[model samples]
Target: MAKETEIEEKNLLTRNEFDMLADTYQIKPPQFFWQANTYFDTPALEIKEQGAALRVRTKSNNYELTLKQPASAGLLETNQTLTEVEAKRLMEQAELPEGEVKESLHPFIGDTSMLQKLGTLETYRAQTSHETGILFLDHSVYLDTEDFELEIEGSSEEEVRKWLTSILTDHDIPARPTPNKIKRFFTRKQELAR
Candidate 1:
């Protein structure tokens, strides 16, 4: 398990604002690529209640299983690299791999077999480096809902937050409450279920 802290700040963006920010960052349109993320939880939503999220993400045919948990500093992320075969099995059969990520889930989910696919969200994303850290532009679609977001990821929360705020101020873009993608996805999933 490769464990690390994830610190980022986010803001909701309009399509026009997204384009304007790309210009501000001097990024071209061709920089974006697709990323697919499949989320998992017990049928009873045990993982959600525990304030954790489990997901398999694909980038350039490489699969990574990651478990994100609440931490004192930010989110504690534990990642496990998976081979193509392992990723295929998990996606097709809901068979979670036996490794660090699964082991870490034991406290919240006793029987690993309880894990099930919650849903998938796909994003067309691009990023550019910044002195503060990195700036990510995302247009994600899932459960028939689409949204745009700007994320500032850095080694420290305070830095990311300050940079994000400055970007908003400089661009005259109003800040919108931005929750993490998982929460947004799960909230929409629940809405569709009703």
Candidate 2:
């Protein structure tokens, strides 16, 4: 299940900061699109406990099953294409369609059947490439939470991070502590349940 592993760095921003970056870079509206990500885990959140995540993301009628695990370089991602039916079973019944993604999850969460759909997060994302890395500005909504984030993924984490820092600093924007989208969604879900 070793595949598509890479480092992704994220920074949270205020509404003003997001708009400022957009204006500063002259980012066009044509680069924006929407995506919905549905996350899954055991009733006790075994995946997160193991420092891993599982999700089925749907974009333009295509469904993909992805498993993310913590790795030395960054996060190791194993991805597999899922048919509409397979995606349905995975989301509705906590079933894996039998493939690399399933095999990858077995080591982390022994019983895949325990998985349950956490919730779906919808994001309107704008992206463009720079000399250092790919830049993403995301506005996401899930449950009762809405947030904006800046993410950069490039050939190397250090280079991309330094580049991101310089831009934020030049604009006098304080980088806020940021959590991955899954964490934010799970946090809000837990809060509302309590």
Best of the candidates, TM-score: 1
TM-score versus the correct structure, for each prediction:
0.97, 0.94
Off by over 4 Å in 2: none
Candidate 2 local accuracy as lDDT? 0.86
Q: For candidate 1, lDDT tens digit of each residue in 1-194?
A: 69999999999999999999988888787899999999999999999899999999999998999999999988999999999999988888889988999889898899988788888999999999999699999999998999999999998888998999999999999999888999999999989889
RMSD of each predicted structure: 0.9, 1.4
Q: Candidate 1: global Cα-lDDT? A: 0.92
Q: lDDT of each structure?
A: 0.92, 0.86
Which pairs, if any, clash in model 1?
Answer: none
Please report the TM-score between candidate 1 and the true structure: 0.97
